[model samples]
Target: MIAATPPANATIASTGAAGETASKLDAIAAQIEAANQRISSNAASIETAAKRLNTLEDTLDSTRKGSENGLIVLAKADQRLADIQAQIDATKQTQTTGAEAIANVARRVDSIEMAIAKSAAQASQHETVSAITGKSADTASQPALAAISQQTSEPQPRIASAVPAQTGGHITAPDTAKPAGDRANDAARTDLRIAEVEQALAFNKAADINTAKLVAELQAQVSATQQTVAGNTDVIAGTTKRMDTLDASMARMDARIADGERSLTANVATDSDVAKLVAELQASLASLDKRLAGDEQSLTDNSAADAETRIRVGALEAGTAAIAGTTGQLQAENKDQGKRITSLEAGLASVSATAKEALDRAIAAGKLAEGKLLFETVLSEAVAEFAFDKATLPKAAKVELKTLAEKLKAENQNVYIEIQGHTDNVGGTAGNMALGQERAEAVMTYLNSEFGIPLHRMSALSYGESRPVADNKTKSGRAQNRRVVLVVLK
Candidate 1:
């Protein structure tokens, strides 16, 4: 207002200076952003390098531990192989001994057969001598033959003349003396032949008995040897299979080790490459730090971004751990449930089998037909029937009961027979219960005392009117319901 005069140079200089300052600030902001990007990239690369180093350390540690364990396992396997070889050697020795024994038995059997044949020949010869002797004696007894012989012999005529002095007979004393020496000789020969035949027969009988004993013993030995050979063969085959499996396992382990060595080599090369990259990143980070020092105002935004990234990484780690824990818990629950289901299924199958067997037995005994039976009639016929108040079993009932007891004893089956007493709904619950218990006790007592069945093998139980198989309102049903049942418990 005093002069109103403006300098044109001053205005132009101020405008140009303001424009240059704005351009410098924009260039500085771009540089700061590029530096922040380089820092973030370097930080991420450093984190990756750190993780790789930790992984390498863990891998090396695990590899060392596994190699130590493998050495221990290999030592154990070597010992097992040695033991198996010893067992095989012992088995071979046993086989050799058994084979030798069998050969010896065969020789003994052959000797026995030869002795039997010789004895039979001697018996045949004795039979032929006896037949000839009988024929010769018959011929000598013939009158015509005796007369011819006497006429032919000169001495015979003299003997006949000496015997003619006797009143109405031949010379019997001289004639008998003439044959006495020959008869004694023939008799001695026949006795010697009979003694030889008897001795041969005795020897043959002894040989036959010995042969039979040897054959039986040899058969037993052969059978035992065969069983041993079979067992040894199985053992050898199994051992060979196991050895092959172990060798295959060792081969696989060696292959894995080879693969691991290759992998370790690759990892070492990768680590060297990563180390070069880390060095480059560190050089770049140093350049970024120098540049950032010139533009220190840009550091606040980069620092905030790093803090946020750290928080996100921590959250991810926590989430991964939680998931692993949940997965483990679920797996454990699944295992427990699987075991429970298997147990229940097994129990159900056993119960079903037992029930089926019981039903089959009942049908075979003619106590049931098509799942139906006259309960009281079947019980009365199969078991001892008692009156409402009677404690003693009838003789006929005792006999039947004894037969059943004998059968059980003969089979050597331990059975617990529960005599369950039931009643009709004719009395109060208390009274019916008492009556049922009394009836069951009476039946149990009779079976034990009359049949010699052990008291421990029997028990009396009263169901009273609690478990009625038929309607209590009907007479027929009531009769069916009022009964004693013998249940065999396993």
Candidate 2:
């Protein structure tokens, strides 16, 4: 086996050799330190950026919370205003209902008082007529009766709630209406009838004494009813005034409710404006959120970059330390280096003599990888007349390839074959390529079928007219160019 050889020999010369190597190592170490310093500065910058990003993120969060709180407060205020307005409306409605009830009470009281007064006036008229007629003084008192109560909405009369159960008396013919002229006419007619009756009664002394007693009784009853009517009229008037005051108060409440409703509408409009502001804030927040996300992603990316830089710095440090260790070893080995260099130089001459084959192999490896591997052994033959454009191999070509394949089969499996077919430039480039390919495939098929060569061991290539050893201007040159070449290699 060929021996391994060092690329170069080094001698520790008497000229401060260890110091020279130490200087080089120090220079490498210095470069490493500088790289580390640069890496540290970048990391510092990244850290500062990250802190700023975090602060910005926190600020955004606080701002978002404040915006949310503002929105919530506005919503609550709007709700409160709505509730208050509702309460005001309800209060206004209640006042209205109360006023109506008061008015109804006042009307009922007025009806009772008016009915009493009318009945009293009618009774007084009846009593005066009786007095004038000179009826018996022992005439019995009439049962007391109250007039019908009037309703506000309906014209029908019903019992009045405020009217007393008993009064002083009832008239024989109670006037339905209390108009002054109608009452005067009725009184006058009754007086005329009474005068006629009195004249008749004057002739009867018993009737006259009875009439005097009835007149006294009638006068007393009339006086008592007049007093009752006056008292109730005062009460009815007071009640009417109270109802008017209540109506005025209800109207004021309605006005206040209208104002409150207007205020509520304005508040709702303000709420709408607030909502628009909130929407703008939300959009701003969304944009901020996107910016924050970008910042976070950048931070992550920067962090990763920083980590990679640190890893590289760590490797540099390890390499610097290794270099330092090597420098120390170099110093220790310096004294014996001259003798070892002599021995290495002597051995290197022999290795250099055998290195050409190895170098050639390396060069060929590169060429093979590039698909430029040269054929070491080339065999060429002219294919006898194949029918025009036919791919069938000529008998002479087949027989020669069979003989070559038998010789190749005697070699090891490392052997590989390449069949190259060429064509004269007779037509277009495309047609020539196809023809060349067909001729190469025909030759390759003959080799595989006749000689048991694995298809993998053989490769067919078409040169077309691009690579011709002969000129294609003449017939003989065309005939010479249209040939197949079989190449063998390891």
Candidate 3:
């Protein structure tokens, strides 16, 4: 047998596939750079929106301050108006009292003047009666005049009486030709009434003088009060006008505040812009997560494939290590092995076929979602389920794998599945490898049963304790090391 030589066409196929993969990686890199630029621009927009929102908030705060100050001013204005109204009311009450006092003083003055006029009229009538009766009334009138002085409207003048006292003064009797009773009575009454009128005139004159004084004082007071009231009215009017003006200004301020509120309500773009920026940032973060996941998967797959290829290449070299003695046959065998190298290369490259084809199809169809793939790489995720030393799959692990399988089914594309089982270095390498393999197979069986993914498309690999994402020194790390990975390449 010719050392099981592989096909010669494998080299040409690998070269073509490599060229295509390189082109795809370059395209992916360029797209990732574009996405980064877009993300940066979106960040700047978000910053601008934040600044604008801050400015609006500041404006709202200032507006509130202004409104508070306006309310304070309005309260002060209201207090002033109340004080002015009180003053006006008090002034009105005072004016009414003052007017009543003036009326009383006027009535008293009129009464005094009427009394003096009546006294004067009675005196003139009595004197006219005496003059008509003549000299016959003199003797009868003398006693009558002395007696009649008691019944009269006139008060005593404290001056000389009509009949003088005999102790210190002399009196003359009137000459009478006959005794005339009616004439005598009339003359006596006239004399007494005349004396009473003179006394009343004197008393009333004195009263008039006092009354005049009182009238003058009262008039002066009334005039002063009028002036004061006039001044108060002017001041009240001014205050009222000022209050009206302040009320109008306050109303205008209220209207302006309402208008500001309306403007704020209408300008929804401010809030919407900020919300949009936040949503975009979330989208960018999600995109970054997906891209990082793809990149990590690609790195892992590349490493595993490279290691497998190196092992195969090393084995071929070691098998040919003792071929120096059979030089002629070894040369023939070298040609055969050269063909075998192509077979191994083709087999290794085939592992990435699904990813390459899917990416190429996406590019051709213009269905490339931005930020989903940062580079040409397999999309893979892991679910760890193995216990400390156990190879059995937990229910929780099954649930996670089921969810992952559902996602894979939704993808609806050709995909290569890889299950990698790892274990802590608690046992011998052989035993660990066996356990790892069993765990990996358990995962593969679940995927096959759940989604009917062909067995050929899925492979199980055992890393045992040789590969660990965490240190095996600690219990947590050892637990972490004992896990399985589910990788999907697209």
| TM-score leader | 3
Which clashing pairs does model 2 show?
A: 135-210, 135-211, 136-210, 137-210
149 Cα displacement, candidate 3 (Å): 17
Rank ordering of all candidates by lDDT, starting from the highest:
3, 2, 1
Off by over 4 Å in 1: 1-3, 56-82, 112-490
Kindly give the stretch of ten consecutive residues in candidate 2 with the minimal lDDT sum: 1-10
Candidate 2's residue-wise lDDT over 270-342, tens digit each? 5566556556655655665565566556545654554354344335333544644565465477845433333
Candidate 3: tens digits of C-alpha lDDT, residues 313-398: 54553444343344456457787654445443332243234335444544555444431322111111122435556767777566
Query: What lDDT does the true structure give each of the candidates?
Result: 0.50, 0.51, 0.53
Error of 3 at 154 (Å): 15
| Quality of model 1 by C-alpha lDDT | 0.50
- Which stretch of 10 consecutive residues in model 3 shows the poorest summed lDDT? 373-382
Global fold similarity of model 1 (TM-score): 0.24
Off by over 4 Å in 3: 1-184, 195-207, 237-241, 244-248, 267-269, 276-295, 306-490
Best candidate according to lDDT: 3
How do the candidates rank by TM-score, highest first?
Answer: 3, 2, 1
